[model samples]
Target: MTDALLVLNAGSSSVKFALYEAAQPGEPPLLAGQIERIGDDPRLATGGTSEPFGQSTDGHAALIGGLLAAIGDLAPGDVRIVGAGHRVVHGGARFDAPVPIGDAVIAELEALTPLAPQHQPHNLAGIAAVAAAYPDIPQVAAFDTAFHRSQSEIAERYALPRGYAEQGMIAYGFHGLSYASIAPRLPALLGPEARRVVVAHLGHGCSMAALLDGRSVATTMGFTALEGLPMGTRSGSIDPGLVLHLLSERGMDVDAVHRLLYDESGLLGLSGISGDMRDLLASDAPEARFAVDYFVDRCARAVGSLAVSLGGLDALVFTGGIGENAGEIREAVGARHAWLAIPPPLAIATDEEGVIAEATARLV
Candidate 1:
């Protein structure tokens, strides 16, 4: 039996997992797959094929069982999973690095749920499911906010009162895992000139980070993931006063405002067509074109802003779904930044699971 490390990134509707040989740290996963559309119509997407997955009464628990069964079928004999690593979003100020999973650590992460409502619960659920499945296996929680802890105090702070800043209201950036995966590869890709870089992780949930000498100096995302570039469904970085106005004059409750911003906005709200960038790019509708333009505009503006933070831009790196796949978006954003006179933007595929596997290996 081969010893392996299991890495899991659980979202609201899916659990993305990969298994890597613990002994081989930076290698590709032995098996990688996602259990997507969990509640409504669950399916296992692996090896470029989608197959129906039977639902069970226990939610993530049952889903995890099916995942283990699939993993069993892939190898010759029993593949022993030595360790598990989870992508826990919003580590807050408490955790600046990956920590071994324990009851106390889970409780601390649970308290951070309010900061990342859309992600935290599902992340915790995945951990719980894994714990139940492999109770004896050592597990580690690799946080998305951990890498951003290298950022300066001023860059992470809000304009709010000193008291609020002291009480953990600082800008804890997300997408650190993706950025971490990209950082080490920059030296090989850009050589000595890889000092200052801007990485735009444009996906369903989008954000950008300004890296100075491969460490986060500033980022577009703030206290919440919603404070950055307009995403697939999120209304990133809206005026705070507008939220208050909705609560007072627009006859909208807190939950209503939350739903509108988190679920009904972004490309879908702008185009009135679809949230997926591929859908918008393909459509002939004026609204779709406008949405695409708006996204590009914001991305360009973010690059300029992050470039200022990095003193100047050396290179701009793109990762995540839209970044790696959507060439049109990249061309448009790069066109807007022509005056910067930097090297051509590079599209790099992020290895978040690989980063998790390595972290878990070091910890265990």
Candidate 2:
């Protein structure tokens, strides 16, 4: 069997997988599918075409089980899954680049749970299961932090106590992998201008980066993923005073605060309908439009802020769900910066599966 590389992005309700031929340069993804609603959907494939590879009561386990079975059936001869790549958010101060996965690494990742409670635990779960499922297949973690390691201390430091910064409580940007995938492509696609670029990664989890000379100089996210533009369900940036007020005056606890910031904010919080950009764009409701506008506004402002960091903007690249498919969002964001000598030319972010495939190939 030709060796194959599998890329997994496990989310709360779904497990999205992309199967790529382990080619030298990672050309294309051959197969891609997702299993959704673990216990509720009770089906293997999101569309219900396949049986549940492994039934599960928990969201994380459901992804692992479904992915295992899918790999078993893909009889891509000689093309067994020789390498697996996972997207892990918040590698903290430890890992600022993609690295091989192992027991010690998994434990370290587990230790950073408090850093990214919503994403880290589940990400580790996928990495661990893939290891157990195919002990021989090399598993690698392509961090969302790796790309942002070049950020200057001014861009990464939190205005908190010195000790907190020393204790790993400083800003370590997310969405580095997406930006990393787009940064190098700029030189080929945008010529010399790609040297100074601002690429917006907009999805359920959103962030933007200013890449000067192909290094992350500034980004939208801060000490935590919570400090960027409002995301699907996350409150991007909020005054710390409000959090303190909620705890002291309103008597809200940490979990309560987490619930509101992570689950009850952003598009869902503003629109009271859906967090999906497509859904909001399709709806005529004022609330929906407001949510859409807010998302675009924050993104536009972030572009301006990062542009200053680069001295100017040469081009703009959009990735992730909303950035790639939401043409209106692209047009709108580009228009905001039309005042610039050259408005950032927008393009579809390259294949993430291909990026991971290439990363794994180099290591394994």
Candidate 3:
């Protein structure tokens, strides 16, 4: 039987997957797809073919089972899924690299859910589902925060107590997998001068990272994914004092504040229509225009700040959904930083699942 690697990125309401014919350096995945709109109108699409998954169960296990069965039916019988890799959103301070997933590892990862409540629980659920479905298969977790482990202590620290920082309450950037997936390509794209680069990963969740010689020197995200650029539904870097005001003066509790910031803010809250950039761009409403403008402004400011961290920027790259597809957004953000003399921002499609597959292949 032919060996293959399955990479899964489980989010709050979707599961994206890719299958790779065992690691061949510089090779691409054999197939990729996602099951989106789960719990509502679940649909599965693979290799550009879309269809209703038709699984009535909303549980993660059922969704994953359906996905695996579908994949099995698509691939030749001689092809075997030998291993799996998961895109775990948070590794806290414990995992600086992709590690094999086991019972002990799962427990440790579970403890990190509070650190990344929106993503970690769903990521863990994917791991559990894969374990139950293919118990003998080796599994590895490629942390979204692992690539930023190269950031300096000062860069990763918060101004709060040093004790809290030491206790894993410091800046642990997300989207590292996306960044890592593109870092190696930068040297070839921009030549050796690309040592100092800033990569803006803009999507439903967004962040910018400063790379010095292809290593993370600093990043915008801190302690959690909500501490960077305003995202689709996340407030990003809001003043902590405002949170206190909501609690003390507005009589909002912790849960209420969480919901407001995590779900009711960002482009959605700003536009009062939808969090999706495409939707906002299509609308003629003033609120939608303002939201789009705000996102561009915030992204431009992040590029400026990251340039300072890198001493200077030789190149700037835009990846992720909005980054790669939204030409107007890219043009606006790039125009704001024109004075920097950095090359026109290069838009590259990020392959996070492929990165996970490669990492898992090494471990297995």
lDDT tens per residue, model 1, 1-364: 8998999987645678998888996897888888876655788898799988876344665787767766778544567998999999889998989999999999999999888987898788878877887899999999999999998889999888899999999999999999999998899999977699999999878999999888999999989878999998899999999999999999999999999998889988999998889889999999999999999999999999999998999999999889999999999999998899988889999988989999999999
List, residue by residue over 190-291, the lDDT tens digit for candidate 3: 999679999999887889999999999999888888898999889999889999999999999999999998888999999999888889999999999999
| Candidates sorted on TM-score, descending | 3, 1, 2
Candidate 1 wrong stretches, greater than 4 Å:
12-14, 37-42, 54-65, 75-77
Error of 1 at 57 (Å): 12
Per-candidate Cα lDDT values, in order, are 0.89, 0.79, 0.87
- In candidate 3, stretches whose alpha carbon ends up further than 4 angstroms from where it belongs are 23-26, 37-41, 54-62
RMSD in angstroms, all models? Answer: 2.1, 2.9, 1.9
Arrange candidates, best lDDT first: 1, 3, 2
TM for candidate 2 is: 0.90
lDDT at 363, model 2:
86
Best by TM-score: 3
Models 1 onward score TM values of 0.94, 0.90, 0.95
TM-score for candidate 1, residues paired by index: 0.94
